[model samples]
Target: MEEGATETPEELLAKQHRKEKKDLQAKIQSLKNAVPKNDKKRRKQLTEDIAKLEAELNQKHEEELKQLKSPADTKVGEMINGVEAMTVEGGDQQEVKQPRVTKAQKRRDKKAAQEKERESRIAEAEVQNLLGERHQEGLKLAQKLAQRQLQIREISSDGHCMYRAVEDQLVQRAVPGLTLVLKELRSRTAEYMRNHADDFVPFLTNPNTGDMYTADEFEKYCSDVEHTAAWGGQLELRALTHVLQLPIEVIQADSPTIKIGEEYDSEPITLVYMLHAYGLGEHYNSVERLKDPANEEDS
Candidate 1:
Protein backbone atom coordinates (compact mmCIF):
# COMPACT_ATOMS: atom_id res chain seq x y z
CA MET A 1 0.00 0.00 0.00
CA GLU A 2 1.19 3.56 -0.83
CA GLU A 3 2.05 5.87 2.10
CA GLY A 4 -0.77 8.21 3.18
CA ALA A 5 -3.00 6.99 0.34
CA THR A 6 -6.64 8.02 0.70
CA GLU A 7 -8.88 5.04 1.61
CA THR A 8 -11.88 4.19 -0.61
CA PRO A 9 -15.23 5.54 0.78
CA GLU A 10 -16.42 1.99 1.58
CA GLU A 11 -13.18 1.12 3.46
CA LEU A 12 -13.39 4.39 5.46
CA LEU A 13 -17.03 3.77 6.40
CA ALA A 14 -16.33 0.16 7.44
CA LYS A 15 -13.36 1.25 9.56
CA GLN A 16 -15.55 3.93 11.26
CA HIS A 17 -18.29 1.37 12.04
CA ARG A 18 -15.75 -1.05 13.60
CA LYS A 19 -14.20 1.75 15.72
CA GLU A 20 -17.65 2.88 16.94
CA LYS A 21 -18.66 -0.68 17.89
CA LYS A 22 -15.40 -1.19 19.85
CA ASP A 23 -15.80 2.17 21.69
CA LEU A 24 -19.43 1.39 22.58
CA GLN A 25 -18.47 -2.07 23.91
CA ALA A 26 -15.68 -0.49 26.03
CA LYS A 27 -18.11 2.13 27.42
CA ILE A 28 -20.69 -0.56 28.36
CA GLN A 29 -18.05 -2.64 30.17
CA SER A 30 -16.71 0.41 32.08
CA LEU A 31 -20.22 1.49 33.12
CA LYS A 32 -21.05 -2.03 34.40
CA ASN A 33 -17.82 -2.21 36.41
CA ALA A 34 -18.04 1.31 37.94
CA VAL A 35 -21.80 1.60 38.60
CA PRO A 36 -23.16 -0.07 41.83
CA LYS A 37 -25.98 -2.64 41.54
CA ASN A 38 -27.98 -0.87 44.30
CA ASP A 39 -28.00 2.45 42.39
CA LYS A 40 -31.19 1.95 40.38
CA LYS A 41 -30.99 5.31 38.52
CA ARG A 42 -27.42 4.67 37.33
CA ARG A 43 -28.31 1.07 36.40
CA LYS A 44 -31.31 2.28 34.39
CA GLN A 45 -29.22 4.89 32.52
CA LEU A 46 -26.56 2.25 31.75
CA THR A 47 -29.25 -0.11 30.49
CA GLU A 48 -30.59 2.60 28.15
CA ASP A 49 -27.09 3.34 26.85
CA ILE A 50 -26.47 -0.40 26.21
CA ALA A 51 -29.76 -0.68 24.30
CA LYS A 52 -28.95 2.37 22.14
CA LEU A 53 -25.45 1.07 21.41
CA GLU A 54 -26.82 -2.40 20.54
CA ALA A 55 -29.35 -0.83 18.13
CA GLU A 56 -26.57 1.16 16.40
CA LEU A 57 -24.36 -1.95 16.19
CA ASN A 58 -27.21 -3.93 14.62
CA GLN A 59 -27.80 -1.16 12.03
CA LYS A 60 -24.07 -1.12 11.16
CA HIS A 61 -24.06 -4.94 10.86
CA GLU A 62 -27.07 -4.81 8.50
CA GLU A 63 -25.36 -2.17 6.35
CA GLU A 64 -22.18 -4.30 6.19
CA LEU A 65 -24.16 -7.37 5.11
CA LYS A 66 -26.04 -5.42 2.45
CA GLN A 67 -22.77 -3.94 1.13
CA LEU A 68 -21.14 -7.39 1.01
CA LYS A 69 -24.10 -8.95 -0.87
CA SER A 70 -23.75 -6.27 -3.57
CA PRO A 71 -20.05 -5.39 -3.62
CA ALA A 72 -19.07 -1.89 -4.88
CA ASP A 73 -17.64 -1.75 -8.42
CA THR A 74 -14.60 0.37 -7.26
CA LYS A 75 -12.36 -0.86 -4.41
CA VAL A 76 -9.21 0.73 -2.81
CA GLY A 77 -6.82 -1.41 -4.94
CA GLU A 78 -8.88 -0.93 -8.13
CA MET A 79 -8.89 2.89 -7.74
CA ILE A 80 -5.05 3.02 -8.22
CA ASN A 81 -5.30 0.91 -11.40
CA GLY A 82 -8.20 3.03 -12.67
CA VAL A 83 -6.11 6.21 -12.21
CA GLU A 84 -3.05 4.60 -13.92
CA ALA A 85 -5.23 3.46 -16.87
CA MET A 86 -6.19 7.09 -17.66
CA THR A 87 -4.06 8.42 -20.59
CA VAL A 88 -3.60 11.65 -22.58
CA GLU A 89 -5.66 12.36 -25.72
CA GLY A 90 -6.32 9.25 -27.97
CA GLY A 91 -4.92 6.46 -25.75
CA ASP A 92 -6.12 3.09 -24.32
CA GLN A 93 -9.83 2.77 -23.24
CA GLN A 94 -10.19 4.93 -20.11
CA GLU A 95 -12.75 4.32 -17.37
CA VAL A 96 -14.12 7.15 -15.21
CA LYS A 97 -14.12 6.32 -11.47
CA GLN A 98 -16.90 7.47 -9.15
CA PRO A 99 -16.88 7.31 -5.32
CA ARG A 100 -18.91 4.44 -3.85
CA VAL A 101 -21.84 5.55 -1.66
CA THR A 102 -24.13 3.10 0.14
CA LYS A 103 -27.87 3.00 -0.71
CA ALA A 104 -28.83 3.89 2.90
CA GLN A 105 -26.53 6.98 2.87
CA LYS A 106 -27.92 8.07 -0.53
CA ARG A 107 -31.51 7.69 0.70
CA ARG A 108 -30.77 9.61 3.93
CA ASP A 109 -29.11 12.44 2.00
CA LYS A 110 -31.99 12.62 -0.48
CA LYS A 111 -34.61 12.72 2.30
CA ALA A 112 -32.74 15.49 4.16
CA ALA A 113 -32.44 17.59 0.95
CA GLN A 114 -36.16 17.16 0.22
CA GLU A 115 -37.11 18.13 3.79
CA LYS A 116 -35.02 21.34 3.59
CA GLU A 117 -36.67 22.28 0.24
CA ARG A 118 -40.15 21.64 1.69
CA GLU A 119 -39.44 23.84 4.72
CA SER A 120 -38.22 26.67 2.42
CA ARG A 121 -41.42 26.43 0.32
CA ILE A 122 -43.66 26.56 3.43
CA ALA A 123 -41.82 29.64 4.80
CA GLU A 124 -42.24 31.44 1.44
CA ALA A 125 -45.98 30.60 1.37
CA GLU A 126 -46.42 31.98 4.91
CA VAL A 127 -44.79 35.29 3.91
CA GLN A 128 -47.07 35.54 0.88
CA ASN A 129 -50.14 34.90 3.05
CA LEU A 130 -49.06 37.57 5.54
CA LEU A 131 -48.67 40.17 2.76
CA GLY A 132 -51.94 39.13 1.09
CA GLU A 133 -53.72 42.10 -0.56
CA ARG A 134 -50.95 44.58 0.32
CA HIS A 135 -48.51 42.68 -1.91
CA GLN A 136 -50.95 42.76 -4.84
CA GLU A 137 -51.64 46.47 -4.34
CA GLY A 138 -47.90 47.27 -4.21
CA LEU A 139 -47.36 45.41 -7.48
CA LYS A 140 -50.16 47.42 -9.13
CA LEU A 141 -48.71 50.68 -7.80
CA ALA A 142 -45.24 49.75 -9.10
CA GLN A 143 -46.73 49.12 -12.57
CA LYS A 144 -48.47 52.49 -12.52
CA LEU A 145 -45.38 54.40 -11.33
CA ALA A 146 -42.70 52.82 -13.53
CA GLN A 147 -44.51 50.42 -15.91
CA ARG A 148 -42.44 47.52 -14.47
CA GLN A 149 -42.99 44.39 -12.42
CA LEU A 150 -42.07 44.41 -8.73
CA GLN A 151 -40.76 41.65 -6.45
CA ILE A 152 -41.07 41.48 -2.67
CA ARG A 153 -37.89 41.22 -0.61
CA GLU A 154 -38.77 40.05 2.90
CA ILE A 155 -37.11 41.41 6.04
CA SER A 156 -36.75 39.52 9.34
CA SER A 157 -39.97 39.78 11.43
CA ASP A 158 -38.04 40.18 14.69
CA GLY A 159 -38.92 43.08 17.02
CA HIS A 160 -36.72 45.53 15.10
CA CYS A 161 -38.39 44.99 11.72
CA MET A 162 -39.58 48.59 11.37
CA TYR A 163 -36.12 50.09 11.92
CA ARG A 164 -34.50 47.30 9.89
CA ALA A 165 -36.96 47.88 7.02
CA VAL A 166 -36.13 51.58 6.93
CA GLU A 167 -32.41 50.76 7.15
CA ASP A 168 -32.79 48.35 4.21
CA GLN A 169 -34.59 50.99 2.15
CA LEU A 170 -31.83 53.50 2.92
CA VAL A 171 -29.18 50.98 1.84
CA GLN A 172 -31.09 50.36 -1.41
CA ARG A 173 -31.01 54.10 -2.11
CA ALA A 174 -27.16 53.88 -2.19
CA VAL A 175 -26.48 55.08 1.37
CA PRO A 176 -23.00 53.97 2.49
CA GLY A 177 -21.74 52.42 5.78
CA LEU A 178 -24.72 52.88 8.13
CA THR A 179 -24.77 49.50 9.87
CA LEU A 180 -25.22 51.02 13.41
CA VAL A 181 -27.78 53.58 12.21
CA LEU A 182 -30.71 51.51 13.48
CA LYS A 183 -29.26 51.26 17.01
CA GLU A 184 -28.49 54.98 17.02
CA LEU A 185 -32.00 55.77 15.77
CA ARG A 186 -33.50 53.56 18.49
CA SER A 187 -31.51 55.37 21.25
CA ARG A 188 -32.44 58.77 19.81
CA THR A 189 -36.14 57.86 19.69
CA ALA A 190 -36.09 56.73 23.33
CA GLU A 191 -34.33 59.92 24.37
CA TYR A 192 -36.87 62.02 22.43
CA MET A 193 -39.79 60.25 24.18
CA ARG A 194 -38.18 60.82 27.62
CA ASN A 195 -37.61 64.52 26.90
CA HIS A 196 -41.15 65.09 25.55
CA ALA A 197 -43.12 62.92 28.01
CA ASP A 198 -46.12 65.29 27.96
CA ASP A 199 -46.73 64.69 24.22
CA PHE A 200 -46.43 60.84 24.41
CA VAL A 201 -47.43 59.80 28.00
CA PRO A 202 -51.22 60.13 27.45
CA PHE A 203 -51.04 57.73 24.44
CA LEU A 204 -48.87 55.16 26.27
CA THR A 205 -51.12 52.22 27.14
CA ASN A 206 -50.22 48.53 27.49
CA PRO A 207 -51.92 46.60 24.69
CA ASN A 208 -51.95 43.32 26.65
CA THR A 209 -53.16 44.71 30.03
CA GLY A 210 -55.36 47.49 28.56
CA ASP A 211 -54.17 49.85 31.34
CA MET A 212 -52.65 53.34 31.09
CA TYR A 213 -48.86 53.27 31.58
CA THR A 214 -47.49 54.84 34.75
CA ALA A 215 -44.37 57.08 34.63
CA ASP A 216 -42.09 54.26 35.82
CA GLU A 217 -43.68 51.70 33.45
CA PHE A 218 -43.32 54.09 30.50
CA GLU A 219 -39.69 54.78 31.49
CA LYS A 220 -38.97 51.05 31.63
CA TYR A 221 -40.76 50.60 28.30
CA CYS A 222 -38.52 53.22 26.66
CA SER A 223 -35.43 51.58 28.21
CA ASP A 224 -36.51 48.19 26.88
CA VAL A 225 -37.16 49.59 23.40
CA GLU A 226 -33.81 51.35 23.34
CA HIS A 227 -31.60 48.60 24.84
CA THR A 228 -33.45 45.32 24.33
CA ALA A 229 -34.92 43.59 21.26
CA ALA A 230 -38.47 44.60 22.30
CA TRP A 231 -40.91 45.12 19.42
CA GLY A 232 -41.33 48.68 18.13
CA GLY A 233 -44.82 50.18 17.75
CA GLN A 234 -46.62 53.41 16.70
CA LEU A 235 -44.98 55.47 19.51
CA GLU A 236 -41.52 54.41 18.38
CA LEU A 237 -42.46 55.16 14.77
CA ARG A 238 -43.55 58.71 15.65
CA ALA A 239 -40.32 59.24 17.58
CA LEU A 240 -38.29 57.87 14.64
CA THR A 241 -40.10 60.25 12.24
CA HIS A 242 -39.27 63.25 14.38
CA VAL A 243 -35.66 62.17 15.04
CA LEU A 244 -34.99 61.45 11.34
CA GLN A 245 -36.81 64.71 10.39
CA LEU A 246 -38.31 62.95 7.37
CA PRO A 247 -42.02 62.52 6.57
CA ILE A 248 -43.11 58.86 6.29
CA GLU A 249 -46.20 57.55 4.50
CA VAL A 250 -47.81 54.20 5.43
CA ILE A 251 -49.66 52.73 2.44
CA GLN A 252 -52.29 50.18 3.44
CA ALA A 253 -54.39 47.95 1.18
CA ASP A 254 -57.53 48.30 3.36
CA SER A 255 -57.39 52.12 3.33
CA PRO A 256 -57.40 54.22 0.13
CA THR A 257 -55.81 57.18 1.89
CA ILE A 258 -52.10 57.04 2.76
CA LYS A 259 -51.14 57.81 6.40
CA ILE A 260 -48.52 60.57 6.44
CA GLY A 261 -46.61 61.96 9.42
CA GLU A 262 -47.90 64.74 11.72
CA GLU A 263 -46.27 67.48 9.62
CA TYR A 264 -47.14 65.72 6.30
CA ASP A 265 -45.64 68.47 4.14
CA SER A 266 -42.09 67.33 3.31
CA GLU A 267 -41.24 64.78 0.55
CA PRO A 268 -42.36 61.39 1.97
CA ILE A 269 -40.53 58.09 2.37
CA THR A 270 -43.18 55.47 1.58
CA LEU A 271 -43.59 52.01 3.16
CA VAL A 272 -46.26 49.33 2.77
CA TYR A 273 -48.43 48.31 5.75
CA MET A 274 -48.45 44.52 6.10
CA LEU A 275 -51.22 42.92 8.22
CA HIS A 276 -50.92 39.70 10.18
CA ALA A 277 -53.25 37.83 12.59
CA TYR A 278 -52.25 35.68 15.57
CA GLY A 279 -55.15 33.84 17.28
CA LEU A 280 -57.83 36.51 17.92
CA GLY A 281 -55.47 39.51 17.71
CA GLU A 282 -54.20 41.40 14.63
CA HIS A 283 -50.83 43.23 14.34
CA TYR A 284 -48.55 45.08 11.93
CA ASN A 285 -46.56 42.78 9.68
CA SER A 286 -42.94 43.02 8.50
CA VAL A 287 -42.34 45.06 5.34
CA GLU A 288 -41.21 43.73 1.95
CA ARG A 289 -39.55 45.76 -0.81
CA LEU A 290 -41.02 46.02 -4.30
CA LYS A 291 -38.08 45.18 -6.60
CA ASP A 292 -38.15 47.11 -9.86
CA PRO A 293 -37.76 45.07 -13.06
CA ALA A 294 -35.59 47.82 -14.63
CA ASN A 295 -33.23 47.80 -11.62
CA GLU A 296 -32.98 44.00 -11.89
CA GLU A 297 -31.25 44.24 -15.28
CA ASP A 298 -28.74 46.82 -14.00
CA SER A 299 -27.90 44.74 -10.97
Candidate 2:
Protein backbone atom coordinates (compact mmCIF):
# COMPACT_ATOMS: atom_id res chain seq x y z
CA MET A 1 0.00 0.00 0.00
CA GLU A 2 1.12 3.56 -0.73
CA GLU A 3 1.86 5.97 2.10
CA GLY A 4 -1.29 7.52 3.68
CA ALA A 5 -3.43 4.87 1.96
CA THR A 6 -4.82 3.44 5.19
CA GLU A 7 -8.52 2.88 4.43
CA THR A 8 -9.78 -0.19 2.54
CA PRO A 9 -11.92 0.35 -0.58
CA GLU A 10 -15.14 -0.46 1.30
CA GLU A 11 -14.26 1.90 4.12
CA LEU A 12 -13.38 4.67 1.71
CA LEU A 13 -16.64 4.17 -0.17
CA ALA A 14 -18.57 4.33 3.09
CA LYS A 15 -16.82 7.54 4.06
CA GLN A 16 -17.70 9.09 0.70
CA HIS A 17 -21.31 8.06 1.11
CA ARG A 18 -21.40 9.64 4.56
CA LYS A 19 -20.00 12.94 3.22
CA GLU A 20 -22.60 13.00 0.42
CA LYS A 21 -25.39 12.30 2.90
CA LYS A 22 -24.19 15.14 5.10
CA ASP A 23 -24.27 17.55 2.16
CA LEU A 24 -27.78 16.41 1.24
CA GLN A 25 -28.94 16.92 4.79
CA ALA A 26 -27.65 20.49 4.73
CA LYS A 27 -29.58 21.23 1.51
CA ILE A 28 -32.77 19.72 2.94
CA GLN A 29 -32.41 21.80 6.06
CA SER A 30 -32.17 24.94 3.92
CA LEU A 31 -35.33 23.93 2.09
CA LYS A 32 -37.09 23.43 5.39
CA ASN A 33 -35.99 26.93 6.41
CA ALA A 34 -37.31 28.33 3.14
CA VAL A 35 -40.75 26.66 3.12
CA PRO A 36 -43.53 28.43 4.93
CA LYS A 37 -45.35 26.58 7.69
CA ASN A 38 -48.89 27.40 6.50
CA ASP A 39 -48.35 26.39 2.86
CA LYS A 40 -49.32 22.76 3.12
CA LYS A 41 -49.20 22.10 -0.60
CA ARG A 42 -45.67 23.42 -1.10
CA ARG A 43 -44.59 21.72 2.12
CA LYS A 44 -45.92 18.39 0.85
CA GLN A 45 -44.13 18.83 -2.47
CA LEU A 46 -40.83 19.46 -0.68
CA THR A 47 -41.38 16.38 1.48
CA GLU A 48 -41.81 14.21 -1.64
CA ASP A 49 -38.67 15.66 -3.22
CA ILE A 50 -36.65 14.87 -0.11
CA ALA A 51 -37.94 11.30 -0.09
CA LYS A 52 -36.95 10.76 -3.71
CA LEU A 53 -33.35 11.91 -3.31
CA GLU A 54 -32.77 10.35 0.12
CA ALA A 55 -34.28 6.95 -0.77
CA GLU A 56 -32.35 6.69 -4.04
CA LEU A 57 -29.09 7.72 -2.36
CA ASN A 58 -29.54 5.26 0.50
CA GLN A 59 -30.54 2.37 -1.79
CA LYS A 60 -27.56 2.90 -4.07
CA HIS A 61 -25.25 3.09 -1.07
CA GLU A 62 -26.63 -0.19 0.34
CA GLU A 63 -26.24 -1.92 -3.01
CA GLU A 64 -22.62 -0.76 -3.22
CA LEU A 65 -21.96 -2.02 0.29
CA LYS A 66 -23.37 -5.42 -0.62
CA GLN A 67 -21.27 -5.55 -3.80
CA LEU A 68 -18.13 -4.75 -1.78
CA LYS A 69 -18.88 -7.71 0.51
CA SER A 70 -18.09 -10.13 -2.36
CA PRO A 71 -14.70 -11.95 -2.38
CA ALA A 72 -13.78 -10.91 -5.98
CA ASP A 73 -13.16 -7.29 -5.15
CA THR A 74 -11.71 -5.92 -8.35
CA LYS A 75 -10.96 -2.57 -6.71
CA VAL A 76 -8.56 -4.27 -4.30
CA GLY A 77 -6.90 -6.14 -7.17
CA GLU A 78 -6.62 -2.91 -9.13
CA MET A 79 -4.96 -1.18 -6.18
CA ILE A 80 -2.51 -4.05 -5.70
CA ASN A 81 -1.65 -4.14 -9.42
CA GLY A 82 -1.80 -0.34 -9.75
CA VAL A 83 1.93 0.23 -9.26
CA GLU A 84 3.51 -3.26 -9.10
CA ALA A 85 2.31 -6.82 -8.96
CA MET A 86 3.63 -10.36 -9.62
CA THR A 87 2.20 -13.15 -11.81
CA VAL A 88 2.12 -16.66 -10.34
CA GLU A 89 3.05 -19.53 -12.73
CA GLY A 90 3.94 -23.16 -11.91
CA GLY A 91 4.29 -22.45 -8.19
CA ASP A 92 6.75 -19.62 -9.01
CA GLN A 93 6.08 -15.90 -8.80
CA GLN A 94 7.47 -13.60 -11.54
CA GLU A 95 7.30 -9.81 -11.77
CA VAL A 96 4.73 -8.74 -14.37
CA LYS A 97 6.22 -6.42 -16.98
CA GLN A 98 4.83 -2.91 -16.92
CA PRO A 99 3.00 -1.70 -20.03
CA ARG A 100 4.83 0.97 -22.02
CA VAL A 101 3.11 4.38 -22.06
CA THR A 102 2.89 5.45 -25.71
CA LYS A 103 3.67 8.97 -26.99
CA ALA A 104 0.14 9.28 -28.41
CA GLN A 105 -1.34 8.53 -24.96
CA LYS A 106 0.95 11.15 -23.37
CA ARG A 107 -0.11 13.74 -25.96
CA ARG A 108 -3.80 12.98 -25.36
CA ASP A 109 -3.33 13.27 -21.62
CA LYS A 110 -1.51 16.61 -22.03
CA LYS A 111 -4.33 17.91 -24.28
CA ALA A 112 -6.96 16.84 -21.72
CA ALA A 113 -5.04 18.64 -18.96
CA GLN A 114 -4.86 21.81 -21.06
CA GLU A 115 -8.61 21.66 -21.75
CA LYS A 116 -9.33 21.31 -18.03
CA GLU A 117 -7.12 24.29 -17.24
CA ARG A 118 -8.86 26.39 -19.88
CA GLU A 119 -12.27 25.48 -18.56
CA SER A 120 -11.24 26.39 -15.02
CA ARG A 121 -9.94 29.78 -16.20
CA ILE A 122 -13.20 30.54 -17.99
CA ALA A 123 -15.25 29.63 -14.92
CA GLU A 124 -13.12 31.86 -12.71
CA ALA A 125 -13.57 34.77 -15.10
CA GLU A 126 -17.33 34.31 -15.10
CA VAL A 127 -17.41 34.25 -11.31
CA GLN A 128 -15.28 37.38 -11.07
CA ASN A 129 -17.56 39.21 -13.50
CA LEU A 130 -20.63 38.18 -11.55
CA LEU A 131 -18.95 39.42 -8.36
CA GLY A 132 -18.80 42.97 -9.84
CA GLU A 133 -15.11 43.34 -10.74
CA ARG A 134 -16.16 44.69 -14.14
CA HIS A 135 -17.57 47.77 -12.39
CA GLN A 136 -15.07 47.81 -9.51
CA GLU A 137 -17.98 47.80 -7.02
CA GLY A 138 -17.56 44.72 -4.83
CA LEU A 139 -14.40 46.05 -3.20
CA LYS A 140 -16.02 49.36 -2.25
CA LEU A 141 -19.17 47.70 -0.89
CA ALA A 142 -17.11 45.10 0.96
CA GLN A 143 -15.03 47.80 2.60
CA LYS A 144 -18.16 49.61 3.77
CA LEU A 145 -19.66 46.42 5.16
CA ALA A 146 -16.44 45.68 7.01
CA GLN A 147 -16.73 49.04 8.75
CA ARG A 148 -19.80 47.68 10.52
CA GLN A 149 -17.85 44.52 11.29
CA LEU A 150 -20.00 42.94 8.60
CA GLN A 151 -19.38 40.92 5.49
CA ILE A 152 -21.48 39.92 2.56
CA ARG A 153 -23.34 36.61 2.56
CA GLU A 154 -24.01 35.83 -1.08
CA ILE A 155 -27.51 34.65 -1.93
CA SER A 156 -28.31 32.48 -4.95
CA SER A 157 -29.34 34.50 -8.00
CA ASP A 158 -32.26 32.22 -8.90
CA GLY A 159 -34.90 35.01 -9.13
CA HIS A 160 -35.66 34.67 -5.42
CA CYS A 161 -32.89 37.02 -4.36
CA MET A 162 -35.11 39.47 -2.47
CA TYR A 163 -36.70 36.88 -0.25
CA ARG A 164 -33.55 34.80 0.19
CA ALA A 165 -31.58 37.89 1.13
CA VAL A 166 -34.15 38.67 3.79
CA GLU A 167 -34.19 35.05 4.92
CA ASP A 168 -30.43 34.97 5.33
CA GLN A 169 -30.42 38.04 7.55
CA LEU A 170 -33.24 36.78 9.76
CA VAL A 171 -31.49 33.47 10.34
CA GLN A 172 -28.00 34.85 10.57
CA ARG A 173 -28.86 37.72 12.91
CA ALA A 174 -31.67 35.89 14.70
CA VAL A 175 -33.64 39.15 14.51
CA PRO A 176 -36.42 39.64 17.02
CA GLY A 177 -39.05 39.93 14.35
CA LEU A 178 -41.15 37.67 12.16
CA THR A 179 -40.30 33.99 12.39
CA LEU A 180 -41.11 33.65 8.69
CA VAL A 181 -38.81 31.66 6.44
CA LEU A 182 -38.19 32.56 2.82
CA LYS A 183 -41.50 31.10 1.57
CA GLU A 184 -43.36 32.52 4.52
CA LEU A 185 -41.78 35.93 3.87
CA ARG A 186 -43.03 35.69 0.27
CA SER A 187 -46.53 34.80 1.46
CA ARG A 188 -46.70 37.66 3.93
CA THR A 189 -45.33 40.20 1.46
CA ALA A 190 -47.84 39.15 -1.21
CA GLU A 191 -50.73 39.32 1.25
CA TYR A 192 -49.71 42.76 2.45
CA MET A 193 -49.50 44.09 -1.09
CA ARG A 194 -52.88 42.65 -1.95
CA ASN A 195 -54.51 44.22 1.09
CA HIS A 196 -52.93 47.58 0.34
CA ALA A 197 -53.68 47.49 -3.33
CA ASP A 198 -54.15 51.25 -3.56
CA ASP A 199 -50.56 51.76 -2.37
CA PHE A 200 -48.98 49.14 -4.66
CA VAL A 201 -51.19 48.66 -7.74
CA PRO A 202 -50.45 52.11 -9.09
CA PHE A 203 -46.74 51.23 -9.27
CA LEU A 204 -47.33 47.90 -11.02
CA THR A 205 -47.69 47.23 -14.75
CA ASN A 206 -48.42 43.99 -16.60
CA PRO A 207 -45.68 43.42 -19.17
CA ASN A 208 -47.61 40.78 -21.09
CA THR A 209 -50.58 43.11 -21.77
CA GLY A 210 -48.50 46.31 -21.77
CA ASP A 211 -51.03 47.97 -19.49
CA MET A 212 -51.67 48.70 -15.87
CA TYR A 213 -52.79 45.60 -14.01
CA THR A 214 -56.57 45.32 -13.84
CA ALA A 215 -58.26 44.09 -10.66
CA ASP A 216 -58.25 40.45 -11.78
CA GLU A 217 -54.66 40.58 -13.04
CA PHE A 218 -53.50 42.21 -9.83
CA GLU A 219 -55.06 39.39 -7.80
CA LYS A 220 -53.30 36.85 -9.99
CA TYR A 221 -50.02 38.70 -9.48
CA CYS A 222 -50.38 38.44 -5.73
CA SER A 223 -51.18 34.74 -6.04
CA ASP A 224 -48.03 34.19 -8.13
CA VAL A 225 -45.93 36.01 -5.53
CA GLU A 226 -47.23 33.70 -2.83
CA HIS A 227 -47.04 30.43 -4.81
CA THR A 228 -44.36 30.92 -7.43
CA ALA A 229 -40.63 31.73 -7.40
CA ALA A 230 -41.27 35.04 -9.15
CA TRP A 231 -38.52 37.61 -8.93
CA GLY A 232 -39.04 40.29 -6.30
CA GLY A 233 -38.42 44.03 -6.53
CA GLN A 234 -38.91 47.38 -4.78
CA LEU A 235 -42.68 46.89 -4.32
CA GLU A 236 -42.01 43.57 -2.62
CA LEU A 237 -39.45 45.23 -0.36
CA ARG A 238 -42.01 47.77 0.79
CA ALA A 239 -44.49 45.01 1.50
CA LEU A 240 -41.84 43.13 3.49
CA THR A 241 -41.20 46.18 5.66
CA HIS A 242 -44.86 46.28 6.65
CA VAL A 243 -45.20 42.50 7.03
CA LEU A 244 -42.06 41.83 9.02
CA GLN A 245 -42.26 45.23 10.76
CA LEU A 246 -38.46 45.39 10.65
CA PRO A 247 -36.41 48.01 8.87
CA ILE A 248 -34.33 47.04 5.84
CA GLU A 249 -31.31 48.93 4.58
CA VAL A 250 -29.77 48.47 1.19
CA ILE A 251 -26.19 49.58 0.44
CA GLN A 252 -24.93 50.14 -3.06
CA ALA A 253 -21.68 50.93 -4.81
CA ASP A 254 -22.54 54.35 -6.34
CA SER A 255 -25.91 55.31 -4.98
CA PRO A 256 -27.73 56.53 -1.90
CA THR A 257 -28.81 53.95 0.68
CA ILE A 258 -32.38 52.66 0.65
CA LYS A 259 -34.00 52.55 4.07
CA ILE A 260 -37.43 51.10 4.78
CA GLY A 261 -39.60 50.83 7.91
CA GLU A 262 -37.66 53.42 9.85
CA GLU A 263 -40.76 53.94 12.03
CA TYR A 264 -40.34 50.46 13.51
CA ASP A 265 -37.23 51.36 15.54
CA SER A 266 -35.56 47.95 15.08
CA GLU A 267 -32.14 46.86 13.97
CA PRO A 268 -32.10 47.22 10.23
CA ILE A 269 -31.28 44.14 8.20
CA THR A 270 -28.59 45.33 5.82
CA LEU A 271 -28.33 43.93 2.29
CA VAL A 272 -25.99 44.79 -0.57
CA TYR A 273 -27.78 45.52 -3.82
CA MET A 274 -25.67 45.08 -6.95
CA LEU A 275 -26.63 46.48 -10.33
CA HIS A 276 -23.76 44.74 -12.16
CA ALA A 277 -22.94 41.84 -9.85
CA TYR A 278 -24.35 39.28 -12.28
CA GLY A 279 -24.81 38.84 -16.01
CA LEU A 280 -28.48 38.09 -15.37
CA GLY A 281 -28.67 41.52 -13.65
CA GLU A 282 -29.70 42.71 -10.17
CA HIS A 283 -28.72 40.64 -7.11
CA TYR A 284 -29.01 40.97 -3.32
CA ASN A 285 -26.72 39.68 -0.55
CA SER A 286 -27.07 39.89 3.22
CA VAL A 287 -24.61 41.73 5.46
CA GLU A 288 -23.75 41.05 9.07
CA ARG A 289 -21.00 41.89 11.50
CA LEU A 290 -17.98 39.65 11.32
CA LYS A 291 -18.97 36.43 13.09
CA ASP A 292 -15.99 36.60 15.41
CA PRO A 293 -15.67 39.94 17.09
CA ALA A 294 -12.13 39.07 18.09
CA ASN A 295 -11.06 38.68 14.47
CA GLU A 296 -12.15 42.17 13.51
CA GLU A 297 -8.56 43.32 12.80
CA ASP A 298 -7.94 40.60 10.23
CA SER A 299 -11.18 41.53 8.44
Q: For residues 66-155, what per-residue lDDT tens digits would candidate 1 score against the true structure?
A: 544454523333432345443446555576566677886577546545754764575465346435654355444434333222233345
Segments of candidate 1 deviating more than 4 angstroms:
1-151, 173-180, 207-209, 262-265, 277-299
Candidate 2 deviant stretches above 4 angstroms: 1-135, 175-177, 208-210, 291-299
TM-score of each: 0.45, 0.54
- lDDT per residue (tens digit) for residues 1-299 in model 2: 36635555666776778897897798678666654443344557779867866876686566556545645334333442353544455545566665565665456446545754764575465345445453357667766776677767778888888899899888877656555698899888888998899998888788887788899999999998999989887789888988878888999878888998898898887888988766677888877555553343244
- C-alpha lDDT of residue 108 in model 1: 52
The models' CA-based lDDT, in order, is: 0.59, 0.72
Per-residue error for 123 in candidate 1, Å, reads 17
Question: Which residue pairs of candidate 1 clash?
Answer: none
